[model samples]
Target: MTETLARLNATYTEHVIEDFQKKRVPVEIPLCLKEDRIAYGHNLEISYPLKEVLDVSYRYEPGKIGFLYIHTIQGVRTFQINSDPAGFVEQFHQLDHL
Candidate 1:
């Protein structure tokens, strides 16, 4: 069963797979957390399963935008959103442990 937990603004960075194998492509897309997968991108949607998420990392700087890194099957995908990293981590942990 898939359920959307949150939708946030994301920045595609590092080793995220994109159609046509674009490099350093920057685009603002809606990132959604679902029960089964995380959905991202605009025209080219990328979905990563929750079970494939090997690690979750967060960085918060006073004057800079916060980042959330999700290490999944496709590699590390980054995000810059207004939501709290701690809250996201908490939710992720709960869902992972379930």
Candidate 2:
């Protein structure tokens, strides 16, 4: 098994009852970065291997949430992240160099 380099949670929207009304709420999902792949989802059902990762980037807003983009061979995947993605991006870059 490969060691996990970093773990971050991505936010997704889910329909739920709030104040007796159905509303869209943010849900947290697990995203794990291994030496070879990035696994994400409630049960880590989806993953993109490092070899398939074309690029990674983060977009931050002044007062809004941040976004992380993973460009893979398959397609571009975006994740809504609440915290700074600088650390995660840095780690990915470091591992990519190895």
Candidate 3:
């Protein structure tokens, strides 16, 4: 997760999100099959920090509706309140267990 956050921070640090927030509307988590960690929807929100990192931890895998978490950057943050449930295989086909 630290590596992932660093990659995001490098490309989308504080300044980037500040510009984005100003130009666009805020929305819930953007569903994406974007990375090995996220392809299964097991990973969650991307943090965009402006100056400081508050904390980082895995609250859950984020495969349920109303599941929410905070991503921070300095003084700014975006809440991703997801409202989607995992599909049968769509959610677990990749699992090494089961």
The model with the greatest TM-score is 2
Off by over 4 Å in 2: 16-22, 61-63
Which pairs of residues collide in model 2?
none
Clashes of each: 0, 0, 5
The local distance difference test score of each candidate is: 0.71, 0.86, 0.30
> Per-residue CA lDDT of candidate 3, range 33-96, in tens?
2223321122445423322333322222446423322333434333333333233213323333
Residue pairs of candidate 1 with colliding backbone atoms: none
Q: Best lDDT goes to which candidate?
A: 2
Name model 3 segments beyond 4 Å from true. 1-25, 39-65, 68-79, 88-94
Q: Residues 16-67, candidate 2, lDDT per residue (tens digit)?
A: 9978999998899988888899999888888898999988899977568889
Position 7, candidate 1: lDDT: 64
- Candidates 2 and 3 compared: the better one by TM-score is 2
Colliding residue pairs in candidate 3:
49-73, 50-73, 51-74, 52-74, 65-83
